[model samples]
Target: MTVSPAPREHDVLTDLLTQVGYRNEKAFAELYRRTSARLFGLCMRMMGDPDDAEETLQECFVVVWHRAPLFDPRLAGAMTWLMAIARNKAIDRLRQRPRTQGARDIDWDALPDTSPGPAEDGENDLAYRRLSDCLGALENRQRYCVRDAFFSGLTYVELAERMQVPLGTMKSWIRRALQQLRACMTP
Candidate 1:
C-alpha cells in the first residue's frame, strides 16, 4: 500500500471542519483523504484485529464528519485531537470484545447492592421512576439497545455487531432513543 505524506501542522483542517459542519461532502472527503491512514494505523496498533481496526477507523471518520466543527485547536493541535479521537474509538472497540472464553456465569446474590442512604435513596428512586417512564416510551429495538448499553455495559459498536446492523444505523437508533427519553423526562 502507498503511504501518504504526513499532514502539515498549519493546514486548515479546522476550516475544512467548518465546511463539514455545513454538510459539505467534498470537504469531508478531503479531510478523510488527508487523515485516514494515520488514524487507521493507530487503530490497527491499539486494536490488533484488522476488522476491528477498520471499523474503528470508519467510526472515527464519521465522528469527524459529523462533529468536526466542535474541534478546538487551542485545547489540542489538529493531529493530537484527531489521534485522541482515533485512540478512544479503538479502545472502545477493543473493550466491547471478549478476549477469553465464553461469558462466565455468576450468581446475582454474590453482588453487593450499593444503593445509597435514605435521602439519596429517595432521589435515586425518583430518578429510576423517571428513567423507567421515559424508557417505556421508546420503540422496542431502541429500548433494547439502551438497556443493553446501560445494564450490560455494551458500547454502540458492540451493539451494532450483536444486532447485525451497520454502526451508523445503530448510532441513529440510540440517538433517537435518547432524544425520545429526554423529551419524556423533560418537565
Candidate 2:
C-alpha cells in the first residue's frame, strides 16, 4: 500500500526553503506543483483571460523564487503570503499598458470641459474639509509633511527638497505624523 506525506511535509519544505538557495529549481518546481492550480484559477478569475493568467502565474513564481529568503513564517501562513504575491503580480500584468501621447496639439478651449458635477464636487469638498480639519489638529510641521506626502504624492526625497529639510528629518516627521493620524482616527 502507498502512503501519503503528512501536512508537516509542506511545513518542512518551507523551513528548508530559507536554507536552500533559489537556484534549486527542483524545490521551486515542488512548490509550484502544490500551489500553481489555485493561483492560476485566481488569476484567471481576476484577469478574465486564460493566456494572461498563465503569464501572470509564471511571473508570480519567478518572484516567489527570488523572494523566498524574505518570507517570514511568523507573520503569516506560507500560502497567504504566496497568494498575496500571486494576486499582486496578476493585478500588475492586467493593469500594464503603453501610455501613448499624440504629437498634434489642439486648442485647449475646443475641448469639452466635463468637470465633475456639483454633487461630486460637494462630496469631495466635504471629505477634504473633514481631512483638513483633522489635519489642522496636528502639529504644524507634522501636518505639512503629511499633506505633501499624501496629497502631492511626493516621496521623502521630494518632500525634503521642497521643504528644504534633511531626508532623515522628513522621514522622522512623516513617521510621527502617521502615528498621530492613526491615533486620532482611532476611537
Candidate 1: regions farther than 4 A off: 1-9, 101-187
Candidate 2 is scored at a TM of 0.46
Could you tell me which residue pairs clash in candidate 2?
A: none
Pairs that clash in candidate 1: none
Write candidate 2's Cα lDDT for 82-138 as tens digits.
Answer: 767887886576446322321122222243434333223433554445655677788
lDDT by residue (tens digit), candidate 1, 1-187:
9999964433556566667878899988877876677677667655666897899899998877767778776765555567778877766765677655222222223444442332233334555579777887888789888766643446787788878999999999999999989888787
Candidates in order, TM-scores: namely 0.47, 0.46
Against the reference, the lDDT scores of all candidates come to 0.69, 0.64
Q: Which 10 successive residues of model 1 have the least lDDT summed?
A: 101-110
Instruction: Give the C-alpha lDDT of model 2.
Output: 0.64
**What RMSD, rounded to one decimal, does every model reach?**
15.5, 14.6
Clashing residue pair totals per candidate (backbone < 3 A): 0, 0
